[model samples]
Every structure is written in C-alpha cells, then in structure tokens.
Target chain A: LAKTTQPISMDSYEGQEVNITCSHNNIATNDYITWYQQFPSQGPRFIIQGYKTKVTNEVASLFIPADRKSSTLSLPRVSLSDTAVYYCLVGWRGGGNKLTFGTGTQLKVEL
Target chain B: EAGVAQSPRYKIIEKRQSVAFWCNPISGHATLYWYQQILGQGPKLLIQFQNNGVVDDSQLPKDRFSAERLKGVDSTLKIQPAKLEDSAVYLCASVPGQNTEAFFGQGTRLTVV
Candidate 1:
C-alpha cells in the first residue's frame, strides 16, 4: 500500500472551483489513483479515478501527471452541499487491492 | 440496484461486553471490506473478503475482533470483551469486481461505556 499526503483543510465559496492535490511518492507502477467524498455520518463515495492524464465524469475530474506520483481532484462551481472530506487512495487494479487512505482534505464550501 | 445494507444503525454497550454487526452487500459484489472509523479520523481497514475467502486481515485485531462471510453473501463482525477504544463506526463496503467502484452502507455506530 502506498501512503498519501494531502492538505488538512481547504475553504471555498459558492461557484468557485476547488482543487485538492495528493502526493504519493511511493506510488507503484500498477497503482491507480482514486478520489472519494465523505459527508458527515456517511460512508465515502467514489468521485473519480484515473491511471494517468485526465479523466472526467459527471461528478468530478481526475488529473494524473506523467510521473504518477501525484494527482489532483477538481470540482467545478462548488456549492455549500459540496462540503465534505476528500480522500485520495492508491492501489492496484486487480489482486491485493488494498487501498490506503490518509487523513484527507476537509473542503468547507461556504455561501 | 440496492446499495450495501447494515443493521442496528446504533449500538451502545458496556466495556467487556460483546457486540456484533451485520452487513449485506450489493447483489453480485465479490469484494467486501470492513473498516473502523473513529471520530475526526479517516476510516481504517480492518478486513477484506473476496467471495467468502479472506483477502487481507492484517489490520484486524484477531484477539478481540472476528468477521466472517458465509456462503459469500451476508457477513457478520463480532467483538468480544470490547474496550472503550472499540467505540467507533463500523463500515461495510463492497464492489462488484476488482476494478469497479465500491458501495458503502450507512455503518453501525458503536458506543462503549
């Protein structure tokens, strides 16, 4: 399992974009980067995943640099409801998929 | 499709007592995971099972905590002689396959007094 480091917390206002970066210096070649969102009293929800380059979905976008040592999660036009803890995980796709999580970045979206 | 299901959304027990939690994963999900999340902290993986077989349990406290998935369907996690530190939310998550997204239940909050 690879370790990840992220900002402890971030503040954003409505209609602003939020980008949270994660660092995994020991990321393996077979590992994929994934982002999850967790609201209070709820389990984490998958937001986006990518192996390299950029991947976008209805919820968010994932940007992975060529080095694969770091990734960024981009949320556009945030709202107060978007306030949650964001986790970045790195793990293999198939066998022994042990995804490890860090303290996570708490994004506080305000009006 | 339904998401993961867990029972007894809340539980309170005295120290040295026993408690158990049940979980039902989404239909056709092969991988199931149990995690313990403390307040103000990220969830910690306790165990992982793939189709009724243990995949990883290195982080599980074998002496006081045990979990099993019989017939590869419903699962149960038990804690014996629980301590105050055992008070935390037990979360169950499952995925259809190795590469797919995982679905999580609301989780069982355990409070040990």
Candidate 2:
C-alpha cells in the first residue's frame, strides 16, 4: 500500500475551481491513484482515477505527473453541494485489494 | 443498476452486547470490502473479501470483530461485547473486478451506549 498525504482542510467559494493535491512517494508501477468523495452520514462515492497523465470525467479531473509520486484532483466550477470529504488512495488490485485511506481533505464550499 | 445494499441503517446497543450488520454487494461483483469510519476521521479498511474467502482482516480487532462472506454474495460483520469506542459507521463497498472503482452503500451506523 502506498501512503498518501493530503491537505487536512480547504475553503472555497461557490462557482470556483478547487484543486486538492495528494502525494504518494512510494507509489508502485501497478498502483493507481483513486479519489472518493464523501458527504455527512453517507458512503463515499468514486470521483476520478488515473494512472498517468490526465483523466477527465464529468465531475472532476485527475492530473498525474510523470513521476507519479503526486496527483492533483481538480473540481471545476464547484458548487456548494460539492463540499465534502475527499480522500486520495493509491493501491493495486491483485492478491488482496488493500486500500489505505488518508485523513482526507475536508473541502468547504461556501457562497 | 442497483448498488450495494445494507440493512438496519442505524443500530443502538449497550456495552457488552453483540450486533451484526449485513451487506449485499452489487450483482456480479466478485470483491467486497468492509470499512469503519469514526467521527471526524476518514474511513478505515477493516476487512476485504474476494468471493467467499477472506483477503485481509489485519486491522480488524479480532477480540470482538468478525466478518464473513459465505457463498460469495452477501456479507455480515459482527461485533461481540461491543464497547463505547465501537460506535462508528460500518461501510460496505464492492467492485466489479480488479483495478476498478468501488461502489459503496449507505452504511450501518452502530452506537454503543
């Protein structure tokens, strides 16, 4: 399992873009970086995942640099509803899918 | 498509009591996971199951925590002699196969009084 470190909390305004970065210095070649969004009292939902370069989806975009040691999740035009706890996980799927989650970055989007 | 299903959305029990939570993963998913989320903290992986076998339960407190996924369809997590610190949300998630994102259920909130 690759240890991930991210910001504890962040504050943003509505209709603004928020970028949360996570660093995993020991990421393996087979490991992929995945992000999940969680709201109060609800299970986390998948946001975006990437192995290298950039992967864009409807909700967010994941940018992985050449080193693969760090990745950034960008939420474009985030709304108040996007305020949630975002977790960054780095792991592989083989023998046992052991996913280690970090403290996560509590994103606060206000108007 | 239906997602993961968990019953008894909320459970309240006294200390020294036992409680079990159920989880039905998405149809055709071969992998299941159990996670515990405490207040003000991120979810932690407690156990992982592939089909009907246990993959990992290193973080699970074996003294009181036990889980099973028989027949490889649904799973149940039980806590014997619960403690006040056992109060947390138990989450169940599953994925279609390898290297894919996991789908999570609403989770079961257990409160030990």
Candidate 3:
C-alpha cells in the first residue's frame, strides 16, 4: 500500500478554481492515483483517476507529474454544493484492491 | 438505475448488544465492498466481495464482525457485542467488473452507547 499526504483543509469562494495536491512518495509503478469526494453521511464518490500526466472529466481534472510522486485534483467553477472531504488514494485497479484512505483535505466553498 | 441501498439509516444500540446493517447493491454489479468511516477520518475498507464469494477481508475484525453477500445481490454485516469504539458509519459500495466507478449507498450510522 502507498501512503498519501494532502492538505487538511482548504477554503475557496464560489466560481473559483480549487486545486488539492496529494503526495505519494512511495507509489509503485503499478499503482494508479485515484481521488474520491465524500459528503457528510454519504459514501465517498470517485471523482477522477490517472496514472501519469493529465486526465480530465466533466467533474474534475487530475494532473500527475512525470515522477508520479504527487498528483493534483482541480475543481473548476466551484459551488457551495461542492464542499466536501476529498481523499487521495494510490493502488492497483484489481488484485487486493485494498484502499487505504488518508485524512483527506476538507474543501469548503464559500459563497 | 438505482444506486446502492442500505438500511436502517441510523442505529442506536448499547454496548454489548448486537446490530446488523443491510446493503442492496445495484442490479448486475459484480463487486461489492464494505467500509467503515469514523468521524474526522476517511472511509476504510473492511471487506470486499466478488459476487457471492469473498475477495478480501484482511481488515475485517473476524472476532466480532461478520459479513456475507449471499446470492450475490444483497448483503449484511453484523457486529456482535459491540463496543463504544464501534460507533461509526458503515458504507456499502459496488462496482461493475470492468471500468465503471464504484457507487456507494447512503451509509448506516451506528451509535454505540
């Protein structure tokens, strides 16, 4: 399992772009970086995933550097409803698939 | 398509009592997972099931916790002789075998007194 480190909390205003960075110094070659967003009393929802470089979707964009040690999740045009705890995880697609979640960054979107 | 469904939404029980939570995965999902989420912390995987068989259960406390997904559709997790530390939300999630993202149910909040 790879250990990930990220910010504890971040504050952003509505319509601003919010970027949360995660560092996984021990990431293995087979490991893929994934991010999940969790609202209170709800299960974590997958936002985006990537191995290297940049991957974007309608929800968010994931930017992984060449070194693969760190990845950033960018949420554009944030809304108050986007406030939630965002987790960064590193693991393979299958085979064990044990997800070790770190204390994610609590992103609060202000009005 | 309906997402994962879990009930009862909230459970309050005394220490040493037993409580069971139920989860119904989406139709045709092959993999199911259970997670424990404590306050101020991210969710932790307790077990995973591939259809009706267990895939991974290394983090599950076998002594007091047991889960089964029989017939590969609905599942149940039971904790006997619960303790105060058992207070947390139990989440159920399911994913298609290929590349679909895992969908989670609104978790069951367990409060042990």
Candidate 3 segments exceeding 4 Å error: none
- lDDT values for all models: 0.92, 0.93, 0.92
Q: Is the docking of candidate 3 incorrect, acceptable, medium or high quality?
A: medium
Q: Which ten contiguous residues of candidate 2 chain A have the minimum total lDDT?
A: A92-101
Off by over 4 Å in 1: none
DockQ comparison, 1 vs 2, better candidate: 1
lDDT of 3 by residue, B26-79 (tens): 898888999999999888889999899998999999999999999999999999
Interface RMSD of each candidate, angstroms, one decimal: 1.8, 2.0, 2.3
**Tens digit of per-residue lDDT, candidate 3, span A1-111:** 899999999999999999999999999998999999999878899999899999999999999999999999999999999999999999887633666789999999999
Instruction: Considering only chain B, report the TM-score of model 3.
Output: 0.98
What TM-score, computed on C-alpha atoms, does each candidate reach? 0.98, 0.97, 0.95
**Inter-residue clash pairs, candidate 1:** none
Ranking by DockQ: 1, 2, 3
Better of 1 and 3 by DockQ: 1
Error of 1 at B14 (Å): 0.5
Q: Write the per-residue lDDT of candidate 1 for residues B31-97, one digit (tens) a residue.
A: 9999999998999999999999999999999999999999998999999989999999999999877
DockQ of each: 0.63, 0.62, 0.57
Residues A1-111, candidate 2: write the lDDT tens digits.
Answer: 789999999999999999999999999999989999999989999999889999999999999999999999999999999999999999885544677778999999999
lDDT by residue for model 1 (A7-90), tens: 999999999999999999999888889899999999999988899999999989999999998999999999999999999999
Worst 10-residue lDDT window, candidate 3 chain B: B94-103
lDDT of 1 at B51: 91
After superposition, the stretches of candidate 2 with alpha carbons farther than 4 Å from their true spots are A93-96
